[model samples]
Target: MTARTAALAIAMAAALATVAGCGRKAPLDTPYQAAVDARKEAERNKEPLPPEPEKPVADKRFILDGLID
Candidate 1:
């Protein structure tokens, strides 16, 4: 193929890749939910329960922090 045709092919491939990557992403389940699911699955299989997931700590920023910007 001509150099111009090869360059066009590469450009089209890159554009297609960019468009594919822009598709909507799936939402992830929270850690607590994941732990619950694991517990349920273990119960169904008569296996030992897995360790609980740790709770997320809340940020302790000062009240005035929210006033900026």
Candidate 2:
């Protein structure tokens, strides 16, 4: 093969190798990702998600009483 043809073939091979190396598993394969997907599936099935504790709200009456007393 000519030098130019050999060089072109090498370049094409290198490009193919680079592309072949880029195959990756989907994020859903990970535990955290699986949990996220499961949560989404539960929501789609209308299952209630676990509730978070409510944050405390500032009571103006308590604050005012504290200030007065």
Candidate 3:
């Protein structure tokens, strides 16, 4: 094969590798809710637990405070 074709192939492979490595993972679960659930489950099992998380700031906003969800 020509050197030009070889270089092209290598460059393409490098770009593909970079793209694959850059894959971003999104959070699959809500941390606040998860914490709340954990606390509840722990209490149910007779284990001592800290107070549950308070309502999120976003939920306490007024209608005119910000854009609609």
Candidate 4:
């Protein structure tokens, strides 16, 4: 291959290697790991999950009369 093409290929390979190395998950995976740890902790503590709140029923007449306004 030509010298210019060889140099370009080397540069591209180096750039790809740098990006691949930079993409390591040790730093970015902390939050997910923490979440998993927290879930396990909650399970260990035998904490029950909170109940869902009840939604209010809409008053159709009040809405039509603009009483909500």
Provide the global lDDT of candidate 2 against the true structure: 0.73
Rank ordering of all candidates by lDDT, starting from the highest: 1, 3, 2, 4
Higher-scoring candidate on TM-score, 2 or 4 = 2
What are the per-residue Cα lDDT tens digits for candidate 3 across 1-69?
999999999999999999998955976657788788889899899999978787767656687867755
Candidate 3 clash pair list: none
lDDT of 1 at 14: 100
TM-score order, best first, reads: 1, 3, 2, 4
Query: Local error of candidate 1 at 35, Å?
Result: 0.7
| TM-score to native of every candidate shown | 0.41, 0.39, 0.40, 0.37
- Show how many residue pairs clash in every candidate, following the order shown: 0, 0, 0, 0
What lDDT does candidate 1 reach at residue 35? 91
Compose the digit string of candidate 2's lDDT tens values, residues 1-69.
999999999999999999988976654375555566667787899997644334456556665687767
Q: Put down candidate 4 lDDT per residue, 1-69, tens digits, no spaces.
A: 999999999999999999888754764645445666666777799986334334456545654576545
Decoy 2 TM-score against native: 0.39
Best TM-score goes to which candidate?
A: 1
Alpha-carbon RMSD of each model:
5.0, 15.4, 6.4, 13.3
